[model samples]
Target chain A: MKFAVVVFPGSNCDVDMYHAISDELGEEVEYVWHDVDSLDDFDAILLPGGFSYGDYLRSGAIARFSNVMKAIKKAADEGKPILGVCNGFQILLEAGLLPGAMRRNNTLTFICRPVKLRVENNETMFTSQYERGEVITIPIAHGEGNYYCDEQTLQQLTANNQIVFRYEGENPNGSLQNIAGIVNEKGNVLGMMPHPERAVHELLGGADGLKLFQSIVTYWRDAHVVTT
Target chain B: MYKVKVYVTLRENVLDPQGNAVKGALHSLNYREVQDVRIGKFMELLVEKSDRDIDAVVKEMCEKLLANTVIEDYRYEIEEVVVQ
Candidate 1:
């Protein structure tokens, strides 16, 4: 499958995602500059995590207005698969592809460590590699990673089976319902506070996150347009 | 013109480390009367009526990007005012 990763001014993880997909997974991937007006020639788009725009004007606030995001919004409406990780998750929230806002870590400190996440719903295209309610540990790093949503909306999210991942043990960032990740109602857009790309290689200490990318590849392959 | 003030907060299920730190400080200071503390972010948006269906547009902006209606609640109002 052909994949594209957007590169914002401050996107430090762009290479990581690029290498993980190309060098590691041996998949064809392209890097789209943030200023690009369109997301053509790619099946899936990824907004890898990093301090986009130096996390100024709030983490994802500034990056939300980036040129390519407008294209991403339209693509999502067109049923394209878009994944946002870490700061990418913040950007997704800012882009409104998913519900909930990321707040300052209740501890008010930047946290970086491998965190255990519970797979809330795997029926979606992203996490189908694991059973629903399964647990996996991946590294999470962010200062304003706390997630917030209203009570009723939280209830609606749970009722609709839209939640994708949650912190398995203690809530690290004080995310509502220990939420680590969530998908849009259509399940094509996913935003997670953890860094799955960072955890994709066992040599990196844990391969727990590889399943996410692998799953994406498998799902796209099953759809039959992909070249192995 | 319309002005919308949106306040965002973490839901109860999420941990509030800032709140916890404040609570701990309050107790340490011997001010046990303080029950709890939580922190939230606030945003104010101003849009002109000529900006195209300001109300609907703003609502869509909030839902699409501004506020994460999930853990935060946002309310807005219309007004005519002068800025010096």
Candidate 2:
């Protein structure tokens, strides 16, 4: 029921993530600086999007070396649910928490708009609230969201149902197999380029992304809270 | 001193949009016979003499920070320099 939004220098989406968890989802949330070494107090870890380390060298490359990443790895090993959106997704890839890497959008442009995403698998802790094959509108904003992995890795992902979200219509960034998001083999860590926190309110455009946050809370309650 | 020149390029299986764009530009300029084009990054590092093996050091640096082995391939040339 508690969330820690990891804040790196140049992290622009930390506030948005905090707002989503606190105001929209009504959950306990706080900002954890990248320098912090431990995340023992938080139940879920959220890595927000931004031009971390100014996206120098490569997106998420420099930020991966931050002190907090070691603790994040520890959290992953403990099976804590971690969500990385946008550049946060890039960081997770660089940190090796998730597979694959991002590349320049095939069109070579920064894309920003709401795109339809099909829920590829609904069994993961993050997407349990979404119905299988359900189409939801989530906004994506990035220039290097083109996800790539070796063929063998792709086969494993497909076999394990790790590919969580796929572009429903046109592949905006030319991601392989229209992959918009994926989860680790354990299914606890999710890295997606689309901004779910940004779409928690209907007024903003759509409320389709709210279920993802709700799903995390549901998973935590099921594991931690005992029924009378 | 050692001057290390590192070159990092996308793996053969990966696509390079920037390189493709540049190739398109060349074609528009009427430069036929240009078979293919690929883009990559170049970096220079000045390393002071150390007890560690230079080749091993450079390789470790490239694998750890300078390049991502998943999607990128890196090569380096070391030039020993005498500092005054």
TM-scores for the candidates:
0.79, 0.99
> Candidate 2's C-alpha lDDT?
0.95
lDDT score of residue A224 within candidate 2: 100
Tens digits of lDDT, candidate 2, A86-157: 999999999999999999999999999999999999999999999999999999999999999999999999
List each candidate's DockQ score: 0.41, 0.90
Error of 1 at A210 (Å): 1.5
Compared with the true structure, all predictions reach lDDT values of: 0.83, 0.95
Itemize residue pairs with steric clashes in candidate 1. A96-B64, A106-B17, A106-B18, A148-B71, A149-B70, A149-B71, A150-B70, A150-B71, A174-B15
Looking at model 2, residue A205 earns an lDDT score of: 93
Question: What is candidate 2's lDDT per residue for B1-84, written digit by digit as tens?
Answer: 999999999988789899899999999999977878889999999999999999999999999989999999999999999888
| Candidate 1 local Cα displacement, residue A83, angstroms | 0.3
Q: Model 2 TM-score?
A: 0.99
TM-score of chain A of each: 0.96, 0.99
Docking class of 2: high
